[model samples]
Target chain A: MTQEYQDGNALAGPLAELFAVDVTAATGRCVSCGDTRRVADLRVYGHALGWVARCPSCEHVMLRLVRAPDAAWIDLQGTLSLRVPLPPA
Target chain B: MGIVSPGFRRRRRDDDVQLPPGQYLTEDFPVLSAGPTPNIPLDRWEFVIASETGQEYRWTWDELQELPAEEPTVDIHCVTKWSKLGTSWRGVSLDLLMEDVETTADYALAHSYGGYTTNLPLEDLLDGKAWIVYEYEGSELAPQHGGPARLLVPHLYFWKSAKWVRGLQLQEFDELGFWESVGYHDYGDPWREQRYAGD
Candidate 1:
């Protein structure tokens, strides 16, 4: 049994339409475990059931996303805070 | 209609067999996984079914093959709205595996090797409804396709037929698995078009 998962880098493509900034470079704090890390460092797991990015420290679900033909449902109740980098004006 | 993703390659049309509601036929068995593919060596692979009473029925890779097996050709429907028809699989029926194990449980939670899970009512897993398939299309199942073995419950949405399957835990009460807890329908019946919660 392999306990491997894709890093938060994979979230880039799925979240691109929702955010103008690169979501991967942003950081999120896991509500369950209180672990803070870059979105690119979280463990991302996705399949036909849809995409789930869990906290690397506690495996608590930090993000949940299900995509349809025209819409994507994303739930982020597990995230306590998300800090994103802003570009210079 | 949804907005088409840029550069999304569309699948070819082939509607020979009748499909369930809202589903289109897919000629290829697309590889989909919740995580990295589990690398379970045949020697280390196993299957376990724990009854509500704590009795465990275990089947190792070798032992699983020693039992009587069947080749079934069935149509599979995915909650993602893709259906594959007339797919051939080789494996032992769940009816044979659950013949002796005692359980008053109403539901079961299937646990996978890569920490993924899905739940089902025991009624949906018995009779001639499910199997632990090890081969697909006459070839050894690949790792990406649930490798050494996977629970093949074609009647339900494909998610219930978990890939990288490891074991099952029978429950006396309703216990939602990973997908079910995350808003997907609890009992994913493709024919009924039960894809999301409250559907």
Candidate 2:
């Protein structure tokens, strides 16, 4: 397959259902490859199931969001660390 | 439940068309891929069924056209939760494709053109549960929709159907494919709601 993934910005609406903060701007490290980058910079793959964000360098899944009838499953098990940006007071 | 969406314009509209668990009917077919879609020219296109002994049964685009074709109207459920009901397709049945081959393998890992793969029990690909479909909705299947041909195992989740399919390797081991190796379920059954590894 070619490198035809959507930008992490495409993840804003879906991730919004789970987090108040805009997670797309959050920087995180991919556990598989140790590449750190903003969530908005990741390569996102959208399917009928939901959005799967992969590490841009390693192509490993860093996050996946699949929703069921009454539950939403946001799996970030592939992440090592996440640093969400906050506003200065 | 009524299949409701905000101005969905896909295709068929069947009111009260009962859907599988957690699925919403879509009128238009949505195209989603993990990477780029391969464009295989008709001359270079080929389909192979690799037996456990390394025998590759191949069919060229022209030969495939010679095979008896069947038009199947079936419902498809995507892992993303969209269900398309009564979709029409034309293809050769797996039963016919396997008639000449002797295979005792227990599992199949369908390989696609663009490095995509999906595993299934060999039995799941046989007995008329699957096909090598090249046409959808009475027209030549589009590359975006897995042409020149793709595996059609509609019973399992659509991912298990394997888009841009090129070959089916028969082996004794249950080797996981692209999605299966990820967090996606090994045997994706949409009705059972098996979408992830634990589910």
Candidate 3:
């Protein structure tokens, strides 16, 4: 267990398949511990369950994504708020 | 179609046996943590086994070291499709830890130092099925890898072996943990490819 796995930034590729903007760079606050951090900094665990992003402060799951053949389920209950940056005009 | 990145290829050992479906072999052990590594002093660390009715059993670091320890070599499969074969660890067996505890609970929730939790069937933890591992690969388990001590349940996916484990709370009924309540399966079986809720 010496190797460090990918961070939340690894979610950008999969998230881009759904949203127009890059979600990995977004900022969010953990609902459980109230710690704010970039989505990219959240610990990302990829498994058969899909992508799970957890708060680095409290270990509370901030997001869960499960993409099926025709649909996708995104759960963000652990996140109090998500701020997605917009492209500069 | 997905493009294969340059210099990336699945590594395999010639002696490798059958790997579970959808898994690749890896010689390197990956550290996956939901939170920052917790810094707990040995004197301040204790392993607790508590029943739902509030009967508690506690073991200090030194006390744990005095118990019988086993060094088992087993193959561990992570939920992320990485399997490391023939890994060795030294720890006290759950059987020894639960020897005196009288309980009818069928489920146990492992609580960790970083507030991480994972639930498992009581059967999955007994009968030499698991251990509270403090040494890995001839060295004290690293904090990043869930030391002062971590639960080692090799039969299930790595997630079930909660890192930085602090205690086990026996429950009468099944209750989901951090991942189980989310999208991950309640009983994560790597062999069955049970990674999601419906799988």
For all candidates, state DockQ relative to the true structure. Answer: 0.35, 0.26, 0.16
What TM-score would each prediction reach against the true structure?
0.80, 0.73, 0.79
Prediction 3 TM-score vs. true? 0.79
TM-score of 1: 0.80
Chain B of candidate 1 achieves a TM-score of 0.91
For model 1, which pairs clash?
A70-B2
| Candidate 1, residue B106: lDDT | 91
What are the root-mean-square deviations of the candidates from the true structure over C-alphas?
8.5, 7.4, 8.0
Error of 2 at B198 (Å): 2.9
For residues B52-99, write the lDDT of model 2, one tens digit per residue.
999889999999999999998999998877888888999999999889
Ranked by TM-score from best down, the candidates are 1, 3, 2
Scanning candidate 3 chain B in windows of ten residues, the lowest lDDT window is B7-16
**CAPRI docking class of candidate 1:** acceptable
| Per-residue alpha-carbon lDDT of candidate 1 for residues B36-134, written as tens digits (9 for 90 to 100) | 677898899999999988999999999999999999999999888888988999999999999989999999999999888899999998989999999
Off by over 4 Å in 2: A1-4, A8-43, A48-89, B1-15
Compared with the true structure, what per-residue lDDT tens digits does model 2 show for residues A1-89?
44467889999998898899999989999999999999999988885356778888977778877655556667787899999999996
**Chain A accuracy of model 1 expressed as TM-score:** 0.90
Please write out the lDDT profile of model 1 over residues A1-89, one tens digit for every residue.
54446788888998997888898898999999899999999998765578889898888789988765556678888899999999777
What does chain B score (TM) in every candidate? 0.91, 0.91, 0.92
